[model samples]
Target chain A: MDALIEKLKGQIIEQLNLAEVKPEEINPDSPLFGEGLGLDSIDALELIVLLEKHYGIKIQDPKDGKTIFQSLRTMAEYIKSQGKS
Target chain B: MDTITSYAHIKHNQVSVNGEIIFQSYPSLSLPEFLSEAYKALGVSYPKFHKMDAQCKLGFLCTEFTLNGTSFLTENDITKTAIVLSNAASSLETDRVHQHSIDDKSNYFPSPAVFVYTLPNITIGELAIKHKITGENAFFVSEQFDAGLLVNYTETLIQSGTEASVMGWVEVDGTNFEAFIFLAEKQKYTNKNAIFKPLNKTSVITIYNQTIWTH
Candidate 1:
């Protein structure tokens, strides 16, 4: 779980072109949108593409992204639940 | 009288304001590196600037520098300011990236972040959002910097109640790019430090051409 969280952090940074953000700075339990990483709608879409491109995880419902991308931990857990982690 | 108050030019890995060299990284940084260096040197905190494509970044940085030379915003209602810009490439750089993303049918993923900047006018949208400009705006794609078009259209807007304007050319095609942005006003400024050029075809052509030929 720890390894998966770290991996997701790197992926999110690279996928979103967060050049100023280091993987270590992203707290796993912190939110990915609004108050935390401060990602917007466009970044949310990019995160969706990241999941599909890297993990082969296709989110059929866009609404589920709110829960899946809540934080680094949630994203790792989602991938683990899909057996991709 | 309508006058061109302050202006900035970006090219050859250099950023100049009002015909004076303001910043340039030695060894001529790559387009991305140059833009990042210029943004850092400008000392602005627009977080969304990170997500913008090359074209928008080029225009955004140039506009910021142009506006830096004057107190136009503080003196005038920015909401009534018009923005008229022209470009040679029309977002072709980002268009190619978006096209490549969807080209491989077997491994296709079009990024919304990249895809949103597919249009040339997104550059204008970026400036509008950043400056809180709610007035008229337009983006024209021409073979080169059409000084006549820019001068005519921008002056027309200012004459028709637009308080001030930011106009010029911003072009980004692959690794080749340049931007010449200037601020113009509806009336002559009485600011002790203000040095404005007549908003006419001759001055526009002269400055825009000078920047183009400058290294």
Candidate 2:
């Protein structure tokens, strides 16, 4: 799980080019949107693709993404439930 | 006399497809390469701008060159100078890249870097920060280059009491880029109520070359 989280962090940094941010800077349980990371709608879409590509989990509907992407904890929990990553 | 007292342009050293000089300090480099060279020439080392979209880079380059050495205006003067920029492609390249990211099964995740550039007005934001220009700024996308629209916009700014106006057409895609800027000031006519008239091309060329107006 730790390795998976680290890998996700790396992908996030690389895709977003968050030059000022590091993997450790993102709290695993903290929200990825709003005040936590200040990411916007575009970032959310990018995250959705990241989840699907890396974890082999398909997110067919973007509307369901709101709940699934509420936080890194939720995302990790969802991935664990899917038994993919 | 209200005229373009000074002006500057930076184009790709290499001749572009239409024989138009695409402004760049380095001729051998592509869009990303030329952008890096432009930033280096301007002596800016900030990394925040490195990830900006192509349109933003073009707008920033033109605005930086326009404001680099002007001593007549200070930070306060920016609020009075209107920025009117026209372009042929209104973030089409950005949309293209974004669509590619979504369509390509292998690369389904669109890079945030590319997605942010999809907006046509992002360049305006970049210019505003570089020059601290908070005045009226607009981006117009036209099929072909429209010199009439450019002139009309500048005339409006002049009549509206804008102290100065920076107007131009900047188009860039892949290896193609072109930019032309004119800084204008208000002119007073003795016949105040006379309908505004546009000078002929020859007259414009003469006035541009000589920086003098003649009947």
Pairs of residues clashing in candidate 2: B10-B23, B11-B22, B11-B23, B11-B24, B12-B22, B12-B23, B12-B24
Cα lDDT listed for each candidate: 0.88, 0.64
TM-score of the A chain in model 1: 0.97
lDDT of 1 by residue, B139-207 (tens): 998999899999889877876889888899999987789999988887764546544788888888767
In the range A1-85, model 1's lDDT, one tens digit per residue, is: 9999988888888889887788988999999999889998999999989999999999999999999999999999999999997
Cα lDDT for residue A76, candidate 2: 75
- Model 1 segments beyond 4 Å from truth? B189-194, B211-215
Q: What fraction of the native alpha-carbon contacts across the interface, defined at 8 angstroms, is recovered by model 2?
A: 0.37
Second chain TM-score for model 1: 0.93
Model 1: pairs clashing at backbone N, Cα or C within 3 Å: none
DockQ of 1: 0.77
lDDT of 2: 0.64
Predicted model with the maximum lDDT? 1
